[model samples]
Target: MSDNVSDGVSSFADLGLGPELLNALSGLGYEEPTPIQREAIPPLLEGRDLIGQAATGTGKTAAFALPLLQGLSSDEGRTGPAALILVPTRELAVQVSQAFHRYGRGLGVRVVPIYGGQPIGWQMKALERGVDVVVATPGRALDHIGRGTLRPQEIKAVVLDEADEMLDMGFAEDIEEILRETPDDRRTVLFSATLPPRIKGLTGRYLRDPVQIQIGREEAPPGEAPLVRQNAYVVARAHKPAALGRLLDVEAPTAAIVFCRTREEVDQLTETLNGRGYRAEALHGGMSQDQRDRVMGRLRGGTAELLIATDVAARGLDVEQLTHVVNYNVPSAPESYVHRIGRVGRAGREGVAITLAEPREHRMLKTIERVTKQRITVEKVPTVADLRARRLELTRAALQESLMEDDLSRFLAVVEPLTEEFDVMEVALAAVKMAYESSGAAADEEEIPQIAPKAADREGRDRRGAGARRDRRGGTPAQGMTRLFIGLGRSAAVRPQDLVGAIAGESKLSGRDIGAIEIADRFSLVEVPESAAEQVIKALRRTTIKGRKPTIRRERDTTGRRPR
Candidate 1:
């Protein structure tokens, strides 16, 4: 991949966008083009397929979208969709569809988002009405194609957004099938944060002599702050909720997303945060599409300040006001960590990424650090004294702003009377105290216990080098992990990636958290952390594996006995 810059280009107009799209960008307050946009637009506008390696929040949506919108046939007689966009999640599908509408409104362009959670009838109706573009998840798109509701014979262009994530969710087969159904001459574009072997294989097969582009995280022009501040805190599992609360108090973000590992954790944490007086909502795969939409509306409408969610449910979400991203626990994998933190630090705005790690997970944090090639400064949890000081500082700043910008003449009567009855300083102090109290400045008195890195965990990691230590048979469970039994295996076309993808996509556990796998003729065994066993089982049971719902449960102990 080539990291090339468009020299001497600054504005969207410089990149050759039509007046309609340029007017939309100007109305949306976009003054300039992001790096990816400047580089990708020209080539894509020329009908050249491209492979772009850029992180989320890099304005890649507009990069490919503008070209597709500009290339739309101006003829009103067009019947089927001309361009197709495949995203990994329903949320993203909606977001991309909205973007298309905003950019192409002057053109009267029609767009539709197809996904599983939402009713299919709505999508079918949209298709019947004739759309210029279709944004969909792979499985749902494949289903529509099979039902003869979506015709791809006339498709001119296709964009695969977040291709790596789609593959991770076990949508590889579905994606390939959908692409094969489309016209062979269709222009294809792929965007991913990271390029693994599988992604390369797909590009080799599908993207014909594509223009390659790589946009790394931009560095701060000398002496300024980086776009994103990365940091972490060490606390025991029991204190994670309290520690998170304390951090939020000190940070006082305008809007934030707290990432959790499972639906149960997300629910519990949401309740605790709301009880602590923060407007928090939970999002997970277990929630219905309507529920998910409502939660997102609350967040965007400023009615909710925090969104506690699982990785799967939170994918493809872009919130402009989000200022901080908190990890309730260390991410199970480095790629997952990268994806989580990418939600913030977008469009040149500075943001923060904070992680709360247990002592045992300290090593995992280090692994993430090495992979991202960035330092995750481990800071001590904010103390009660710190919280008080921060709150007081906030109160002082508010009063100062009011004095400078607000009309205080109406309150002169009260101030004059107080001055006559008491010292001005005393009256000021009392007013400040009232303001602090009214702002809910009282800090939690209970201090979260500070945890140090565990030496034993470090030593064990040093001994084993980088990878997880597994037994000779590759089936022995690790410490605190248990084996799970699945009735569908090799005979059912089940593979390790399928199991890992199913678990990670369904639950909060990342692929890294899933341990060894042994695929027998009619059964399969995998290891997951004991704490997450039940969640995994429930998730697997609720969903299908390779189109079959297999018996999933904790493996029975059979060491001393033979098969009956």
Candidate 2:
């Protein structure tokens, strides 16, 4: 067997990929293989058991996908899927399945993604008909095995993607169960970001003398820093929304994922950002599989620029053009922070990781910095003047690009006639005004107040209490009463009674405790006693109104205005 590593394999062709796969890769603009792909593809193509250690966005998907697709039998009457890839989350399952379909399109490969929250009837029918590859989450895949719809005996290869995450998510038993069902002689491949003891044990028990490959973390030379520029802004909890808006205006990332703590926070922040004129989408556990798919479609299609998500919902998501990762709040763990920032600074591209920290979370930031061994510059929030300057800068840059690249000859004809009636400078000023307005520059918003960190002892109790409350409420805690932002509004044909009836029917709170309900064009806001907010959100998420479940979250407004 050839033991050539990534250095000798410069392209997919060098890795022994077939012409059909190479053409697909070329069409997708993949000029060369990533390090993991370069190293893992050759051995995998030889049908060798392997263990790969690499983080997300390292092109790990293609490393396994290409080899698996190439190994598929071209026979038209295959009875069962030849390969099974088990992933940790439904999003990853779908993404991996799509990759297989893309790479194997010319080969007429049949791929299916099976996960919970999707109807089982279609999956059953698909499996019964025939498939070449099945990408699935462990839980859903186990369910199919029990139902006898997913025949693992015919599987020729098995892959566990993101094995560490699957173990952390408590899927160890499910993974083992599925593995036991597969044939003993099947090739096994495991990929993980970190190989803890459990993962090592898993590999020892399942893989037979696997080829080990690790793509280590990229370290900067001597004084240089990593590509992802890390920064943090200290702001009070109440001013976070406005501060995020101002900061986004200044940074203006092409696409970003804003990580929130919970489902309610995801929904509320999505609405708040949308109200601020951003195209934002919410992703959380509460959303159905179809809703999640639609949200991802909008993001990938560039119809949405901001994605507000909870950690659980954002797992295993890989967006190629993701330029920024904004932590709306400090992550609970150092590893979580690492994972969040890892989404950016990928593929040798310059990216940014921004964190908006409450004054009390300053120490947590310190912990993250120390653990990651990277300096996080704490910067001041942009002021009104700064925002105005940034907007003007954007306008000037737009005009400059247009002047350089656009064919303005026809527009110059109109400018010539105008110059006959007006001063040249005056005509230019009129054109600039139209260009600025058309670029979507709005009036500057009020500056958010900066927060000063307190001593550790004094801040600890308050921080703990706030965290507890946020956990219960699914977002920032309400002061006296809680206000919830629901994704459905007049657009969904919703009424105040609909909100009232849903809450009253689902939760313990009475209509009297529920305050004013205001339904807007696309969303609604409702207020309830602070103590009952969490219970209300949980209940309403499970119970639907108008035969649909609207995203519900604690209101994030700091303006303290009661919704009419």
Candidate 3:
């Protein structure tokens, strides 16, 4: 282990990784391991039971992933899987599997994601083909065990990712059953953001005198806090995307972190940023660690300046010179907002923190301010005129930088001929204009709008969408109504209140627009007014209930498989 780690090692390779895994890590440009990786790797590599405490994005995934992959059997397994990793949700299952695949690429490891909502046929086939590892959600894994579709007897190791969340989602017993099924000799590794009482008890019961490792919070005392200039922009819900892009255009940050709420949002915004001509990289739980490292590498090398990522996905990211942090949407909690802003303004460097707020989220902004004791200066969305002026300023800056660095002697030769043919100043201006455009220094206005406003936005929405009533507002509904089918049901242990909470909370939908909810053992159906159905779907897509996604669609019938 490296001494800089405080716990030990300077490099990931020194921590006893296999040749192939080390080579892969090097290729990803990961020269040094984070603190969590430095301490956890050696102990886990020795096949010892361990308990790790770390925050999200702290590079904890790699801490366990390397050791878990290292412990795969030298001989073929004789059971369903050699290793079983239990995650709180399907999204995490995919994330962990991708990480393992990336780290073990050269080892020909057969790792697969096994979660519910996704079809079971694929996982069954993978299991039959001899999978080396399995990443699954507790409910789905229990379903497989009940159907006699999986056996954990040959398991060499078991990892519980986000153990706290699993307990929160009421998966403690399910986890115990899966762990008990595995052979007693199997290695155990448990990770949690906080070891609540339940997590502590589980560790006591399952892990055999585990080696405990904790990387505590990194909170700076009051007077020693960072120097981030906090500010926010208010816009309508439909116009936030445009607002974010416009702000980015005017700000013209060299490198920035855009915090999105979900993995799906990360991918979508990454595309949007790229389309705007920014070298953007996507970081999410769904990406493999190698992919993540590559994204980080690009950001570090100045190949990509914008990183679109979720809070959990960006955990443990220590980019040395980030200039700004943009909150695409306000966080659900004030603490998270603080953490997101804390990513920048580190080490006493000047930084900017910008937030894009929907009309209703202004309240959230106030709550955040009160909690952090930081005033978020409210500003109107930048106008087209503002963007144009900013672009011109950037153009002038480029010319100044050029004047200081390049030899004007060669360029003057070409300019002198033009000057002889035309007005000297006109010729020089035209040359500079051509130089700026050719370098693509126009503030990326092609994708982001020049300027936008709020009052006009409400008018536009009224012209398009139906006049839906806001139940939370004590208003009435629009003429028509809509119904959606969510493929989670009572049998899957879903609840109507959970559905209502997810929809009303994430979207602009009011309780009235969310008419009725019907839940069955295998599925559930919901009624939402037509005037707001599209918005409901969009919002529901962003929210997560019981740590599982609820697929929302037009209700086909009262009775249908909705095949959960």
Point to the candidate with the largest TM-score: 1
Clashes of 2: 0
- Per-candidate TM equals 0.74, 0.69, 0.51
- Model 1 residue 442 CA deviation (Å) reads 4.2
Winner on TM-score (1 vs 2): 1
lDDT of 3: 0.71
| Candidates, ranked, lDDT | 1, 2, 3
User: Best to worst by TM-score, what's the order?
Assistant: 1, 2, 3
lDDT (tens digit, per residue) of candidate 2 on 369-468: 7876776767678887776665564455445434534598987778888899999999889888887676556555577876644454335434432212
10 residues in a row with least lDDT, candidate 2: 466-475
TM-score of decoy 2 = 0.69
Off by over 4 Å in 2: 1-4, 18-20, 23-28, 74-78, 217-226, 373-375, 395-445, 449-564
Clashes of each: 0, 0, 13
Candidate 1: tens digits of C-alpha lDDT, residues 259-313: 9999999999999999999899999999888998999999988788899999988
lDDT assessment of candidate 1 = 0.83
Candidate 1: C-alpha RMSD after superposition: 21.6
